[model samples]
Target chain A: MIDVQNITKRYGHHTAIDQVTFSVAKGEVLAFLGPNGAGKTTTMRILTCFMPATEGSARVAGFDCTEQPLEVKRQIGYLPETPPVYQELTVTEYLTFVGRLRGITGPKLSSALDQSIGRLELGSVRHRLIGNLSRGYRQRVGLAQALLHDPPVLILDEPTVGLDPKQIIEIRELIRSLAGSHSVILSTHILPEATAVCQRVVIINKGHIVAEDTPEQLSARLRQSEKVSITLKTCPPDCEMKLRAIPGILNVLPGQAGGSFLIECELGRDLRDEIARVAVLSQWGLLELRTVSMTLEDVFLRLTRHEDHLSEPAEATVSASAERTDA
Target chain B: MTPVQAVIAKELRGYFVSPIVYVVGAVFLLIFGLLSYLYVGFAGAQAIQLMQMQGGMAQINLNDLVFRNLFASMRIVLVIILPILTMRLFAEERKLRTFEFLMTSPIRITDIVVGKFVSVFLIYLGLVALTTLVPTVLMLFSDFDWNPIWTGYLGMVLLGALFLSVGVFASALTENQIVAAFVSFGMLLTIWLIAGLGNLFGDTTAGRIISYFSYMEHYDRLLRGLIDTSDLVYFGSGLALMLFLTHRVVESTRWK
Candidate 1:
């Protein structure tokens, strides 16, 4: 479990994270999505107690990060961007050392080391020095070190950044298997990776959380309402213009169906019945009719760019609604 | 393993695997051998000096064979060897970025500093112990006073300990081994000069205070089979101060 509130990191005049606030529930896998320089790593560092936040407070496992750092660190495992590896040590030696540092000992330490090596699939390179291991193997070693103590939370920063596709898939599968047992907060700019492993995504841009929701909920929230896109098989020449002239019809734009139209209507108005009446009277067959929707990517860009309300009829009517409210 | 034991074992293994440790030991042995037997001509000079004496060789005075060789050997060997041993103690770790892994681990800062210092100190001890054969060889051929040799060996080990501690502190302050070596040599040189610089004064209390600070002046008395408590305190205090400073430096790294 983690709670970060009003967290802002400023280095001199540059702000890395701007008043970001988010929390993760127990055993939940929360993916932090952001573009480059979007402060994803900075936030992860704050959560892991690797770096103090410039402003605000963060708590991990109910322990304050700044005030109770050691306790917070004791409760969470961190795989930094660079992995924090000792190249001269063997995989078993490295994990054993890490386990000892984390207060594991004797049979517990050995068993933990064995489990980590087994889980991360690092058994082949257990006796080989880390310097001779490939990038993927070294990465698994890093992950194993973090998991050796079996901490309840894992804070991984770009865990699969430089790995090949197969390695990435393997690492992802490993992370996916940690779902119910460990609470994870991973930051990555890779959209599909987050979608695959995370139940909820937090899209951040310019040091702020632009949107946070399930993928489907985010997509649904960005869809336009009371607007239907209609494609006609055979329509009159001025069908789109005619649709625009109908009462309660706000706007009509020609679409790609040769004689299709995208129609917007007044609030709480569904003109599908009226449009069907007009289409039948005009002897024009409706081939397909559906509402226009936005994908998660569109919602991500719109919210991050601060343009979410710009094209919404709700926004227009709010000026119109504010004007209406004022009237 | 406990953090302290884990750190100590890792540091010792690092020393065992590193080529620099052996190279330093070989060079130290070579210099000790050259200065003791060939340059000073320990065997030939003694044979000639004994033959030239009118007192029927004075039975090859045991004191000269044991005391003279160890005293002379230490001045040359320790001065050259300690800097090489301590130079990379912390500097190499920093340059390799392996220190970051150690620092960030849950181990205490004191454990790391003490572990590294002990490993390097052990290397110094091993190198010093290897040269004991010079005295052992002399004992086989002549009547030698073992007391002075023991005293001299103790003083040299203590001297090495003191120098290594200062070098450890210097190494912790920088990532460049060259810089650490030079800084340690400079500090050692300053300690070596303190008594002579004291002589420049008109024998005031200030002058005595300055003279008492020189490790070599006390080391010389200790080499002559006399163990002054003041000298013991001087070297002991100096080593303690450096170890403390090394701990501070190691701790300060976390803040950075």
Candidate 2:
């Protein structure tokens, strides 16, 4: 479990994180989403007790990070962006060293080492020098190092950054499997990574937490209107007018394909049935009708774009959803 | 294993697995051998000259003529070599970004500093031990007092340990190994040159204080087989001070 309360990290006149706050319940996976320079790594560093927050407090596994750093460190498995590996040492040697540093020894250390190696599938490269391994293998070794002590919490900063697509999926599945046993807080700029592996998403932009919620909730909350795509067997000049005349329909625009249209309706409105009935009555010969939901990527861009406009007072009230449907 | 022990073990393994230990070790032995050979040759020539003039056996203290000078040369060699040995201790960690891993671990800053200091100290000790073969070979050919020889070795170990702490401190000041080496070299050179400043100032109060700070003054006393408590205190406190400063530097880095 982790609790961070209004932690602010400042460097002279620059604030890396401004009153940013979030927490992860035990056995929960929280994705930290932010663009580059969003202070995601800074926040994770403070939570891991790697650096002290200029103001505020953080606790991991109920141990205060600053007051009880060693205790907090004992319960955390951190994989920094650089992997924190010794290029000269072999994979097993590096993991063994990390295991010992965490106070795991003898039979327990051996078992933990084997478990990490097996879990990360590092058996083939176990005896190879880390410097000789590929980037994907090196990343896996970094993950293996974190899992060596079997700590209850994992704070990984972009764990899948350099991996290939298959490696990314494998790591995603690995992190997903860790949800019920280890509370994970992984930071990444990749929107789909959060949707795939994390239960909750915290979107931070420019040192501020812009949004936090479940992925679905964030998508739904940011979606101000519904969109429906309808395809007709034949095109009519009045098709757009007919769709716009329907109740709750805001706008109807031609789709990229011929005889198809994209309809925008007011929030919480279902125009599919009405459009289908109207098409049948008017002899429009409807071929397909489907509702389109906003993806997590759309929600992320909307939230970040909204934050970007906070500096311009007059345009600040222009809702992200309004701009989306109008565009 | 304890955290400190684990760090020390890992550091030592790092030293051995790389070419640094072997390369430095070979160069150290070569320098010691050449210095010992020259000293033994000069001492032997002096003894032969004395015998020829007196028409009898000349009393020559080989330990005085050879071992003392050998250690003095060793002190200078250590000043040059110990920095090379210790430059990577902390600087390499910073360069490779492993300092994050080390600092974030559950270990204390003192443990990291002390572990690094001790590992390098042990390697220097091993190098010093290898030079003992010079004395062992001298024992085979001549008889000499062991007291000064042993004290001279004690002085070398203490002085080398002191130099290592300085090297570690210098290494902590920067991520560049070359800069660390040069900074430590400059620092030790300043300390060594303080003895000359003492000579220039004579017996003035300022000169006395400066000379007291000179590591050579304390080391000279030990080389003569006089192990004063004050000398031990000087080396002990100086070593501690350097290590403590290194710890402070390392701890301060986390805040920055």
Candidate closest to the true structure, highest TM-score: 2
What residue pairs are clashing in model 1?
A317-A320, A317-A321, A318-A321, A318-A322
- Each prediction's interface RMSD? 2.6, 1.0
lDDT of 2 by residue, B174-222 (tens): 9999999999999999999999999899999998898999898999999
* DockQ score of each predicted structure, in the order shown: 0.32, 0.74
Clash count per candidate: 4, 0
Candidate 1 iRMSD, 1 decimal: 2.6
Error of 2 at B116 (Å): 1.0
Tens-digit lDDT string for candidate 1 (B1-256): 6777776677676677677878888888887776676633565677677778754554555455546555755775676668877888788878876665565455567777787788888778887788888778866866667887788888888888999998999999999999998898888888888878888884899888888888867888778888888888988998889999999887665444
Residue-level lDDT of model 2, residues A186-249, one tens digit each, is 9998888999999999999889999999999998876666878788998788878877899999
Candidate 1's docking class is: acceptable
- Model 2 misplaced stretches (Cα beyond 4 Å): A230-238, A254-261, A274-289, A308-327
Report how far off residue A192 is in candidate 2 (Å): 1.2
